[model samples]
Target: MSTERRAPLDRKRVADTALKLLNDVGLDGLSLRAIARELDVKAPALYWHFKDKQALLDEMATEMYRRMVAGTALDPGDTWQERLRKSSHGLRGELRGYRDGAKVFSGSRFTGIEHAEQMEDTLRLFTAAGFTLAQAVRATATTYLYTLGFVTEEQGVEPLPDERREGYDVAERARRMSDFPLAARAGAEIFADYDRHFEEGLELVLAGIAVRFGGS
Candidate 1:
């Protein structure tokens, strides 16, 4: 560590350092002490700005959301379905951008005003599509929960090396379960084309929403 003097620390500074440390060590390995050391400050000094590690993580989540939405430009003329699709795809991209991004977003208890306002905007879109306020909230929640769940699973998969992948026995299992017609045929394509898979799933969810409240 250099002996260079540092500027006074604030919540954003601490959270920014924590975010970098998160990239280096991942969500499981990130700790308050690690962030403090990364900032060249003592662990106790962090408490002045954040009550604890959770508070730091909340800020990190807020920053992550801020960055994710910074470049998003929603068109006023977009149909509600189009807007929702755009929002879902944009969110997925953001969650996959950083190491353990999904984990950090899911773990934090984000309470920022911006996040609340964003939620309100999404709900308004649903209501504008003809759903009641309660339905709008449920619709927005259902869409995002699906997005979060899908991305979490996507990120959890550790890609096998090309050589190692060839040794996997997925096809063999499908053959052994030949008695089950659907499983046998689908097994070969189970993990292929995730982007297509996610889109298809989203369409199913949106279709349900459309049927339930499209013109209500």
Candidate 2:
């Protein structure tokens, strides 16, 4: 036998592979065998580190949080508002890097310490703005819910197929779209640029928070 030591299987490599697989086949199509094939290893090799698929996915989510922290400063000099905006946009940009990454990383239970720190940063923001920890947590939760919900939808959009392209039946969709002028006119123009919407949502959150806590 050759006396060469194998490079230890790592969480980063595994997460990177999973993200690659996500871009290739999406959530429903991703699998251990696929990841193993991508890594040039047998399926059993992955088991040495992750135990099971869900465990691996959980680690991916954790890694996603760590990635957000790595990409952001959460700085001391920046006001809490600046911190929150940077953190959220950092995560949004990260999710934008791979297909359906937002869908994979969103929701509860899989979040690690880094994820908590995001909320803690938001808490610090609200606290600095003069709210208690409980209030800060609650306010941060609202912003987080909106952010995750928005990102998930955005990530899910690209994978949409011909069959799923709004059904192509304007008359059929008209009843559902009747009340919403914006949704009804969601042609290329509406989606080709999302810069305005992202800023608008962020502004709405900050404005709402300021109104609630600014007077104090």
Candidate 3:
């Protein structure tokens, strides 16, 4: 019997394959050996392209960010606040696309040229809106961190179990929180639409920036 041979390996191919596997095994279950097996190559072969798992993960993150940034649209007519709002929403949508996507992307040290370019563009948005260079940098970093942190927790939330599904109803939640007046009062607001929550939180941050920087 003849043995099947695989194509030559490269960093991109490895990273792409790893991402597909990520959808299946998640970040914690992913391993170099598993990636190699998926490629039908020896595990040691991957080391030639990546020094270690972290290196591979970083490449994966770079690619993910690269694509996300590429897909983002910047409208010239939009005000800085509007631009920031659009960018924030774009980022949230991108991060929520994959399982553990935010966690994996956040774990990376974005040292690639694309990442540098993206950072530069983000800073430009703030600087153009009357912020000093330092302020722009901080604002950009703060927004990025906020989006990442929010999505990380968003994806981390477990779904309601079959047995507990019925108990999670609105009436049941209201009843449970009845004894706790404050929680009961805030229950509806707390469980409001997540999309709206993200939008409102982003607006608050942008509003603070506008107040401090004097942008329209």
Candidate 4:
């Protein structure tokens, strides 16, 4: 074996490697051992950075959020509705970028305070748009939860943009639900054209927020 010095590892490097491995081994198969093997280090080396798998996952989720924020910029002149739409879509895009990405992101906490800045900005935007502080938090949470839940289900069907799991065939589903006439017909609408469906659902969520919170 060739003897070559390796770069020192940190939390960011560990989390970054784990994120890339996520696309291959997925969340279930990912572990500190696997990450350590990829990094050419002993598994114990990782413990210096992450206490356990959940800690590493939190860091990975934070990295994902950081990348999402870095890549997306909202227009300052846009109305609250427009900003919400853009932020929602941007989040969906980021979550869909990896296998089991939404799952990885769901329920994971940030390892640092980096996300607070974005949260502050979002709350400010909503409050500036005529919502009280409480209303702003609720409105933002509503949209965020909708996006998170939507993408989780979306990833369940298509883990990646071009890769769809088995058992979701529309015709097969329609046939399976034949006894329920309307439900049988609804299969196609529910299963196909994810982009259009996501947009329509997002619009509905936005509409509800507007009606309840009095935003433009």
- Ten-residue stretch with the least lDDT total in model 3: 158-167
Model 3 stretches astray by more than 4 angstroms = 1-7, 158-178, 184-192
Q: lDDT of all predictions, in order shown?
A: 0.76, 0.69, 0.75, 0.88
The count of backbone overlaps in candidate 1 is 0
| Tens-digit per-residue lDDT, 74-108, candidate 4 | 77677888888888998999999988898888899
Which residue pairs collide in model 4, if any? none
Model 1: pairs clashing at backbone N, Cα or C within 3 Å: none
User: Model 1, range 1-216, lDDT digits (tens) per residue?
Assistant: 889777779888887788777766878889888888898778999999888778877888888888878857777676767877887888888777766777778868765788776677766766776889988877777888898888777666522112123433567767788899798778556545558878999999889988887743
**TM-score for every candidate vs. truth?**
0.82, 0.77, 0.83, 0.95
Q: lDDT for model 3, on a 0 to 1 scale?
A: 0.75
Residue pairs that clash (backbone atoms under 3 angstroms), model 2: none
Q: Estimate the Cα RMSD of every predicted model relative to the unseen true structure.
A: 3.7, 4.3, 3.6, 1.4
lDDT by residue (tens digit), candidate 3, 1-216: 778766668988999899888877888989999999999889999999999888998998887877787888776566777777777777787767666788888868864687676567667766777788888777766777888888776665522111122343555678887888777767555454567777788888887877777754
Model 4 residue 128 CA deviation in Å: 1.7
Model 1 alpha-carbon drift over 4 Å, by segment? 1-7, 158-189
Error of 1 at 60 (Å): 1.4
